[model samples]
Target: MTVSLYVPLASPVHRAPAGLKLGLLAALAVALFVVDRPEVVGAALVVVVAVGLLVARLPARSLWAQVRPVWPWLVLLLLFHGVFTDWRTGAVTTLRLLALVVAAAVVTSSTRVTELVAVVEWLARPLAVFGVRPARVGLVIAMTLRFIPLIAERAHRIREAQAARGAARMRWGILVPLLIQVLRLATTLGEALDARGADAPVTPPRRRAGASTS
Candidate 1:
């Protein structure tokens, strides 16, 4: 279906280590949450924009499209914050949130689910002593990331179909069908997973695993 929104490509960012990018994201999130200074937030916003442009290679137009959906709600929050708090504070917080969102979008757009899953498993491997199954966790994460965009695309298609079929507005008539279609897709995905033995219990890797591969 020509899914280009967040699919991984052979870009520079894709070549970077996923764990490092995740660490950067975590640091940025912590900074956003703890810092109350507007100047600091603004600086962080600049860093996010610069990184997205240079490292992530996100063009201005695509950046705009990524943030376009959340913009209206951001405006509403800006108004509320300004009235409830102060214009300057509201503006700063709103801008900080936007920067965080953009950073997240850039990371997801650049990183592949396979890379993300591998990172997850590698990170969690040491915790196996506590009975954690990193491979299973990685598989769950992979499936979630993989299907989320697919579900979104299907929903978009359903919405477009309803509109074409003379849906006046987003009434229950349109929403009910969309929900049903989403559920159907989810069921199909679940069935496919079952068929693939994805829900099976995870066992420890066999000793001499290279023997099988060889």
Candidate 2:
């Protein structure tokens, strides 16, 4: 299910500092988890929807596109939870989880990957005292964020290619290739970081290549 929940627009939420938005999202998730009340979750969901509309300036249609993808999963989760647990509590927990997920999507849709990296860097600064390198952490986070969309695009292309080759009906063809491609991407990313001396100090070249060399 594709959720038409967010529009790629230059709105206040999009413009706000990523750290602030991240903090808010984190706090909201924690608060929701602690409360565990349907009424509270419903209220939070309302706030999230309002923020998506008013702060994010996302049109209803666009928001639907963003959310539609997860609707089926949400439905399935609700069914599973309701059946396995007490109906009332299961329904509440499912709704709460859904609210949290939707709220997170709103933030991701509005915030750019660069902004998120900056936020992570800022947030990780304090952890440096514990021997954690904030800059390195930020770089990892940035790389991961950058790769998400790329992976999605690659998966789409792979699916299309498989369909064209009349292998779309075969799950392994798409799944296996997608997994391999993602692993390849991860390897490339690691190689790129190593080239940049991410894990250690770099040594200068002992002999430079000739200027006349192609």
Candidate 3:
């Protein structure tokens, strides 16, 4: 089964406007970096957890699934900082990253794909002056989010196949087949998009010189 990042729920977080959620996320990211104190970051992390669990009402498993793949990297980050710098720095840095990741997972779980795409398209509207297609940009964002879980699923399947073949341990050899599969999928998707005229150029709206475009 293909696992989608967006969870279906009627919670307040889920009903919040996508743009508002994204804006708050951006603010949270900036605040976390600006305040380097571990206590502040820890407090922010607590708030994030409360929002996800209590406000969003998301199952802990859903949040864990998002964080599980990155725990190894987080461990490595802590070890690296602890070795060169200090344990306090390591703890703060690790917690900062963990908070960001979980916060992002919360946003994705609450927001629908279409809602996200619409927000992206709206944000990209100004770039249309430079011949950028907002719709295409939105499509790219949508595809990126959609593909993350799909690629992870494919890698899991490849690992299972390797294990079934009596491979004693996971090896780098899986990358070869995984790459091939990804390339094939991309080619098929591209062909389908072309058939649907997704590559067609969009015409920009005309604006009068005496009026404000905004």
Candidate 4:
């Protein structure tokens, strides 16, 4: 069964606009990086956790699922900083990453995929003047998001199959089949998109007589 990142809830966070959540996430990311204080970053992390649990009313597991994958990377980052730079920098950097990841989890868990795509299309509308189709941009972003879980599912299946085949070291063994399947899936999607005319160029609207190019 495919699981979506979004958790259905009747909370205010779920009801909030997707664009607003995205904007706040962006701002949080910037703020986390700009402020180098570990305590401040730790506080931000606590706030994000509170918002996810209290405000968003998301289940703990939902947020944990999104963050669990990055624990190894965070540990490595901390160790790297401790060895090369000061432990303070490493701790602050790790906290920044953890805070960002949790904040993003809260946003994604509260927002729907369609809502995110709509926000993306709206944000990309101004790029129409540069021959960019907002719909296409939105489609790309939507597909990318969808593909992440699909790819993970495929990799899991590959690993299971390899294990069943008595393969002790399945790491390298799974890669070939996984890559082949991903390529096939990409080719099929590309053909489908081509048949649907997704690659067609959009014609620019004619400008008014008094319209300024600038």
**Best-matching candidate per TM-score:** 4
- What is the per-residue lDDT of model 3 for residues 19-52, given as tens digits with 9 covering 90 to 100? 9999999999998888888888898899998999
Each candidate's TM vs. the true structure?
Answer: 0.61, 0.60, 0.67, 0.67
**Compared with the true structure, what per-residue lDDT tens digits does model 4 show for residues 1-214?**
3457999999999999999999999999999989999999999999999999999899999899999999999999999999999899999999999999999999999998889889979999999999889988988887887788889989998888888889858568888899988887887897698778887864454557984532
Q: Which ten-residue region of model 4 has the weakest summed lDDT?
A: 205-214
Q: Model 1: how large is the Cα RMSD against the reference?
A: 9.7
Stretches of model 4 off by over 4 angstroms after superposition? 139-214
Total backbone clashes of candidate 3, pairs 3 or more residues apart or in separate chains: 0
**Weakest ten-residue segment in model 1 by summed lDDT:** 205-214
**156-191 per-residue lDDT for model 1 (tens digits):** 887788789888586556567667777777768766
Pick out the ten consecutive residues of candidate 3 with the lowest summed lDDT.
Answer: 205-214
- Residue 106, model 1: lDDT of 82
Stretches of candidate 2 off by over 4 Å are 1-8, 81-84, 127-132, 139-214
Clashing pairs in model 4, backbone N/Cα/C closer than 3 A: none
Model 3, position 145: C-alpha lDDT score = 75
Best by lDDT: 4
RMSD of each: 9.7, 7.6, 10.6, 10.0
